[model samples]
Target: MSHLPTLNTDTIWAILNEEIDDKIVNQLVWHYLGYRYNESKQIWDTSAVAEEWREKYPEPPDFIANRPPTVQLTRSIPKENKQLLKEYLGFKGYKIGEFGPRQTRRATMANWLLSYLKEKQMLA
Candidate 1:
């Protein structure tokens, strides 16, 4: 049997409240708004759509953009993806409550929760 890593509340909380790297998030948001990476030029090619989105939200929200991050676990996300994650992990808990308003620690625990379970099992 393979050794399994310890699971703890802090680890879960860390994953749930994890904030994505700024550079990655920035790239994702820019790409979502129709910006492309110019490989040869080593730059991001911007478009009118990107400009408009930037103008509208100078700092785009992590959850609303939905780039597969921790914020999706929270109720703040209007997308159904959060529900799907919970269903996949069989998480049955309060849909919404007072998480103290930071938004990061309030999201669902499905992001890395599945990995922890998978590590402890051998699907056959």
Candidate 2:
């Protein structure tokens, strides 16, 4: 059997929640959003749509792979994804106990959650 790194999701979550800075989150989020897996074209079947989005948004300085727009996971992320999600949402500076305030923008949270599951190796 291969020796894979076993990360403590809870520990990661705690660091992200009580310690991590917004800059890292922003960077990670940017990476996650602009990420394009090598198999994007073959898997996403969105050659046209991705092009459209690219045209709309200015090209990033770094080459974030041309991936499918939708956040799809092939395997499980770590549980930390969920904790990071909660922190991400909280970082948005939204008020709690409010009724669906303004617009619903939780893409970061969703993406983090997905990534967490994948990290945990639970999505397989």
Candidate 3:
């Protein structure tokens, strides 16, 4: 299983200062603040820290904002298999054109639609 990269206070600070844009500082700050009774003193005042940062800098867009929504399957599948899967998705009426210009690939579009369908429990 893939693990989420650990974001330290320093790293978060750097992100807030525009040193990096890999993660959304606001979301991370909210998540940290939501953790009630965190034993770590460093992460204790996440809300205040986040507020200060927000006051100084405009909120940055989420990293996945431009990407099509999809389940990121890590397992390596053959290109031919993926193409077949895309064809199947197309046959199911999940058109790639609906998601906009960037989402032209069948693999990405199909996976995104499938992921949405699965989330709604529409697929068995």
The best candidate by lDDT is: 1
| Residue-level lDDT tens digits of model 3 in 1-124 | 0132244433423432345433433344234323222455533333433453345323322323333112222122334444433353333433555654232232343343344334445554
Model 3: how far residue 64 lies from native, Å: 4.7
Query: How high a TM-score does candidate 1 get?
Result: 0.30
Q: Over all chains combined, what TM-score does candidate 2 have?
A: 0.31
Each candidate's lDDT (Cα)?
A: 0.40, 0.36, 0.35
Off by over 4 Å in 1: 1-20, 37-44, 48-79, 89-124
Ranking by lDDT: 1, 2, 3
RMSD of each: 10.5, 10.9, 15.6
Q: Write down the RMSD of candidate 3 (Cα, Å).
A: 15.6
Q: Count the backbone clashes (under 3 Å) in each candidate.
A: 3, 12, 0
List, residue by residue over 32-111, the lDDT tens digit for candidate 2. 44533235454322233334444543332121232232222212234456444445434343346642311122333344
Least accurate stretch of 10 residues (summed lDDT) in model 1? 1-10
> Candidate 1's C-alpha lDDT?
0.40
Model 2 misplaced regions, further than 4 Å: 1-18, 35-53, 59-107, 110-124
Best by TM-score: 2
After best superposition, candidate 1 residue 91: deviation in angstroms?
A: 6.8
Worst 10 residues of 2 by lDDT: 61-70
